[model samples]
Target: MKRALLATTLCALPMAAAAEGELNLYVWSDSIDPALIAKFEAEAGVKVNVDGYNSNEDLLTKLQAGASGYDIVTPSQHFLKIMADQGLLEDIDAHALAAFQQVDPKWRGQWWDEANDYSIPLAYGTAGFTVNRNHYKGPVDSWKVLFEPEADLQGKIAMLSYPDEIIGAAQLYLGVPFCSEDPAEMKRVYDLLAAQKPFVAAYTSDNIENRIAGGEVAAHFWWDGNSMKIRFNDNAPIEYAMPKEGLVGWLDSMVVPKGAPNVENAKKFIDFMSRIENATAQYNFYGHSAPVAIDTATAKYTAENAPELFPTVKVEFSRSCSPAAQDLVTKVWTQLLQ
Candidate 1:
């Protein structure tokens, strides 16, 4: 009987492995709700592998370096344009997605994917500063606070490491266009960042919530979603502000890579995520607003109580920079790091 049982266990091992399908998802850290993922796995009989990236540039670099086996990726709108231009994305057949119809029309047919062929909008928010009100006892209502930090706040400010965000914020502070390409304007932006470098506690995008919650820094450049997450979770005295200059808007989308190993599974996963219930769950979990309209009492409360989560000022979404401009920005970023 023991020998028969051993043979049966050995036979079942391969069968169990065969029954498990795999989907590789590359997304921002803590962006997806684990509960929704588990539900998808249970329904599809698939094992989901999640990989995280700190910024859109990180994702672009990995894919450009020929990283493969990534079935799905979440890229901001600007990076989506670059990836689509490079032919690195697979066409998302709208007909194949049952939940595609559920997506808000406002998010579709945007400049990034004009035809709406390669990506689906996931979440949208603005970039701003998260301030520790306990330490800073001022109005805290302008880009000057970050661009030209007060002496006391020196060496206590954390800015995002992302080029587009940091550089664009500087441009806005200078009253120039966010995507300015002229050498003089670009130089001004670079100089601004160089000047602020000494005051910055750290240039980071990951773990910013923890850093802010722990009071490691008094001010940080962060997304509204993450700011909300830290505020609610830690109950810290953190406050999110949209400077009088304006807010930088961003939209993250889901797309399948060119050579995804599990294309069908990726589509299925996208469809699953598009469902209203799942979308609401993700919004509540990640503290970012999804394109899908959800009307729960919690959603209403969030909208009514937390106005900072939604930016009211002019919102500019960054677009793909020209190759020359991108190279210049990259060079400036390298200098800032050094």
Candidate 2:
């Protein structure tokens, strides 16, 4: 029996070694450029295999089912909190990540990781609008553009299909807190969103840029980086704007799965990415803020190209939904869409 057991253990060693040198990554499609992956691969000598997901919930479901396959994942801050709470994430060792100090103090010590124990803020951006310059008959400064779709843009505007974003826009317009937990307030926001739904041209998240570029739509609700990417591609006299009602912002974070095999390589990669100059390069390429420590260079880059989004560096307070609130938002959103 001892000799048979020894043979089985020896056979499994090769599989374990293969898994150790390989890092399985699940991320948003096109979130990271291919060149970046090449750099990591050449430097670390580790094979990085990546998969894509369309939504956060899908990532969560997979992680819940034992994420033995994924070593690194890109998740929004809220979901990071959820994963940390469920003990699904590996507690990030600050010592292993010496470059943690390179992160902006503003992003650290937040509710998601009050002690900076679990995740690293990778990228930050906002929810906002994209407008075709030719179609805008007036100032496009507020949520009113969507809530009360202007005559020229009527039937030409596209709204984000997600429940939290749609209802949060209404809540911001209504002057209710962005992440209001009050059930009554949430209901009011839901009603407001439903009222504006008819004016919206099909609920959707993707293809907004295609619709706008093709002139199938005149305006789109979009994330700041995505809007910038679209504008960069075509420079078709399109603009992205934040509403006067105040916009919601999100920090996309990198966290390790609890059972991650390549912990050391993962830490090194994260540290390297958090260097201010390196992070700036990513933001310049991707059009989103990197979470590295703020500096003169970061400021100059933002002021030059994305002034509207730069204001967020000082807009410290942001609303994040609790799980209960998320469930409620989902339920009300389903009804509103129905």
Candidate 3:
């Protein structure tokens, strides 16, 4: 339920404080807490400057367009391989860092970066929808609630402005595999979205918690962490769904981009973030599952309170789509919005 004024462009953010050093960060919107950044600054004497993007495509587009001032970027597991394949990230020897040892064994050796050579694991979560329980008195265990809403949620559903996970969700609902290049299969996705368009209150990715909490919309496509945050912090009567179909798994990692302005400072920030205390601070602030060990009682949320974070259903992590498949996804989303 926190509101931050970060915009999509690097120009919207100030450079950094007048410290001996600085680390420029480009990450997902509202993903990092300011207090944590300040703590890093105070501890390392390196000012941390940040800019945010709404989706993975935005980050990829920025880097492809030659925005290289960022020392560290937070990209999901899939986009990590995409950016690295384009040679836009730095090989910071993340695996060799002492803090890497603290990383949960399950999060290590991820396919996105070999042996964690190019990236440091950050927060992980699932993509799903949340329903305001006060409005709907029916079962809440399926994507049907949003895609084919009941009387209560009619014209009161909101989806992410970005298409990455929305398309993945639709694919799951249709039983189509992620990154399916079949045109006929993709057409079904398009048809399904088009059918649900009339029920959409808005397609947005900004201030989602407020929109849902304030009742501007009754159901919303959202991340598990953010949903739990609104529930725990604002005491909102909302439940994040683990659709019977499946959930999209996502892992955001700390990576140093190629041609970064502050190399050593970026390393310092990574080491600082890897510490258990600091990692716990990040988890408590953002409400996402962390790859590093954290003190649970000292944390803000628990499995008992925010069950959404722990999913029993299968979670299909997205992969980098082929050119044709990605283009079809863009077409499906754009056409549906129009």
Candidate 4:
């Protein structure tokens, strides 16, 4: 019965039948501007019900646990591949979305969803570290400062709570593959993080910007976009840097989940977000660049003032590691927390 239902849904034609109802959006916290949601509601005559999750794993767990009522979801590129393979997402008809053309060709046909079958690129950025310039005077150019802390940085650093990211950063710093399967390589990453745990002020993924702004820690492992958002809006004396050891690049895309009650509305919302003006507004609000290009003036302003938002160094996109590798990292992460 499950197979039959899925096959039927996949065979159904792309239809905008429910164009003026509710769109249940499950995305990252503070990711969408409420004002934009209000605008979308007013214009489309559709009520959007918004829900938030912090990590991609959180979103995946809910969906896997049979949670429903989410018309749309935002998953990072790596998780998108996993979800797509599991048939957790509905196929997107590129021909049905007029604004699909607005997205850059580079973001389209990505390895995660080749042929753009399951996801639409929403925002893209790098994961790195930020420094409170008021407290740390030395150069913030390398992962060593956070992983192998100097005297000043010791006990004044915050690390991301996610296993894949913290472990991946350690892998890069140690010059190992981001998704290495070698037990020795994995153990080295685990040992590195375990050693740094004593120096870490906290392992957290929530309100990281606020904590940094409030001087809770002198340095943190954070996303470039969030770092920029904090610097611009909170006027925090913080600076983001792509570590000398390659940075991890991520792209979060919009996908309609299987059994979405408002599939048409989800498609419309994705298209609405793909427009240049809307995309620019989102970027300005969240500090993450949309995968689509914006107007020349806005692009120029970003180039001149917020150059760090664009990474120029070597980048490694996050990839799904083998289950055994994931298990090892999770084990070490749990130990570090204890």
Candidate 5:
């Protein structure tokens, strides 16, 4: 009976019979601007509902525990593989979508969804540190400033409480390979972070922009796009670093869950978002690079003044590690936090 119902829904997906409804998007906090959501609702006559998750693990845990009613989710590129393997993702046949062709050539056939069968890429950016130039007048070009700060910078740094990107940053700074199954390699990363804990003012992901802009910390871990918004929009004297040691790259994508409440509306939302006007507005609001190119003429912002969006060094995308490798990362992070 369940199989038959899913098949019926899949058959109606391409038809207009299932267009008007709600689209439930489980995405990162502050992502998918509400104005854009309203714009899509106006165009398609479909109401949209959005929710935010703390991390990729949070998304996985909710779905794994039999939670339902989510039509779409935004998972980082690496977690895409894990969710797909566990059968949490619906096969949307994304390549069939008309706007799929408009996806930038570089973003297509990516490691996460090479065949484009299940996910649509939205935003891509690097995770790095942001520094208040007023607080630190020295060079901001490397992770050295973050981990091995000047004497004055001690006790003036902050970090995200979670290990998702921060652990990757630590690994990058120490020149250690990601997902190292070897305990020794993982220990190096833990040691580096543990040593820097004294200098870290706080380890909280909440209200990072305010903390950085309000002169609470000299340096803090943050994404390039959010940092750009704080610097340009809020007039914060902050520089998002393109560290010489490199940075962690991520692409947040839209993927349907296995038992979504509004699958058709989810696809409609994806296509609508892929359109030029909507994409440009989202980019201007979020300040992140997109897998789909927006209409530059309609764009209100660019990477010209925001050097953070345009990196000079290499960006290594995170990949799903073996269970053992994942355990190493988890243990290292847990011990450091404790």
Candidate 6:
């Protein structure tokens, strides 16, 4: 009987360890500050075990493959829809999440996942080039710099490696709809990106900061958050701008995975994160624009200080592409990168 009791205690130890405090989160590497984790843990009494991913596809692949350890995840708005449709996400109970009402109405029923049923928007930003005021004498408000490279920028410019962003930029330049579900429209966008590929310095998803800061490349298409990060860290003379034809943008969200272990806690965590104070801190720390409701201090900060930051509209203008279009875009991007 004594031995059986000891065995029972041992069995309960791991459960206790898992239960007393632990929320596994998978997000972009180096995106969130360690302090944010500590604060959330201290506030909610849960240890956050975070893992980071470099790409949305990687996150989706793992979730789709039935890897079920995470309590929370951050993926772009489109990926959130995909995950929700695949039954990989929990239907976010608005009642359980009081802070969700704090989310802006404009972002609430976005066409991608209308009614804010699937996830909560965390941050928003656009993809564009940061021109070096010191060197770039020409007008800098357009996607034309990279698509139609000038004599000076030839071979010295960089473009994103992602199909959505690169192709979307071309579509925007041509005044065509972006994130098109129509395969033919997508193909046209892909061909345009591929045509511009030869002039690209390298198909890159990283180091736009280093390239821009070091002057290794005069300009490159980069996320506004990443561009802001460069500006914050180096305080460079560089600038982040929306393309004159308008910029390609993205909205990222926090979601509860289908099989998350600590869902009540996940909802609590989401509530804590949704507050404008926390969101502003995240934005200031990481330099990515944070999703803020109207009339909040963070929204005021953005308007007063960083007015160029804007909401992403492609997900609304277009249906975010069907799987067929995604595959075709991927194939074309792969070929162009080769």
User: Which ten-residue region of model 6 has the weakest summed lDDT?
Assistant: 310-319
Show where candidate 3 strays beyond 4 Å: 1-18
Clashing pairs in 4: none
Off by over 4 Å in 2: 1-20, 293-301, 312-320
Best by lDDT: 3
lDDT of 6 at 233: 58
Candidate 6, residue 324: lDDT: 69
TM-score of 1: 0.90
lDDT of 2: 0.71
Per-residue error for 286 in candidate 4, Å, reads 1.2
lDDT per residue, candidate 3, 1-338, as tens digits?
11343331222234344467767888887788677787777676666667777788888888888956999889998899999888999889998887798799988887888668888888999998998887666777788888888778889999998899999999999999889899999999999999999899999998898888888888999999999988988899888888899899999999988889898999888888888888889998889999888877798778787788889798999888989999999999888977
Clashing pairs in 2: none
Model 2 per-residue lDDT tens digits across residues 9-110? 453444544443766677776676556655566566666666667566678888999945777888887677788888999887653476778877878888
Q: Which model, 1 or 2, shows the larger TM-score?
A: 1
RMSD of 3: 3.4
Q: Rank the candidates by lDDT, best first.
A: 3, 5, 4, 1, 2, 6
- lDDT score of residue 238 within candidate 2: 78
11-68, model 1: which lDDT tens digit per residue?
3344446546778888886678777876787677777777677779889998888757
Instruction: Kindly provide the TM-score of model 3 when superposed on the true structure, using C-alpha atoms.
Output: 0.93
Give lDDT per model, in order: 0.80, 0.71, 0.85, 0.80, 0.84, 0.70
Q: Clashes in model 6: which pairs?
A: 141-244, 142-244
Count clashing residue pairs per candidate.
Answer: 0, 0, 0, 0, 0, 2
The worst-scoring run of ten residues by lDDT in candidate 1 lies at 1-10
lDDT of 4 by residue, 264-314 (tens): 888888888878887777877777877876765564237557766878778
Q: Higher-TM-score candidate among 4 and 6?
A: 4
Per-residue alpha-carbon lDDT of candidate 6 for residues 104-183, written as tens digits (9 for 90 to 100): 77677776677677677777777667766565667776777778878777777777656666676777887667555676
In terms of TM-score, how similar is model 2 to the real structure?
0.86
Q: What is the TM-score of each predicted model, taking all chains together?
A: 0.90, 0.86, 0.93, 0.91, 0.92, 0.85
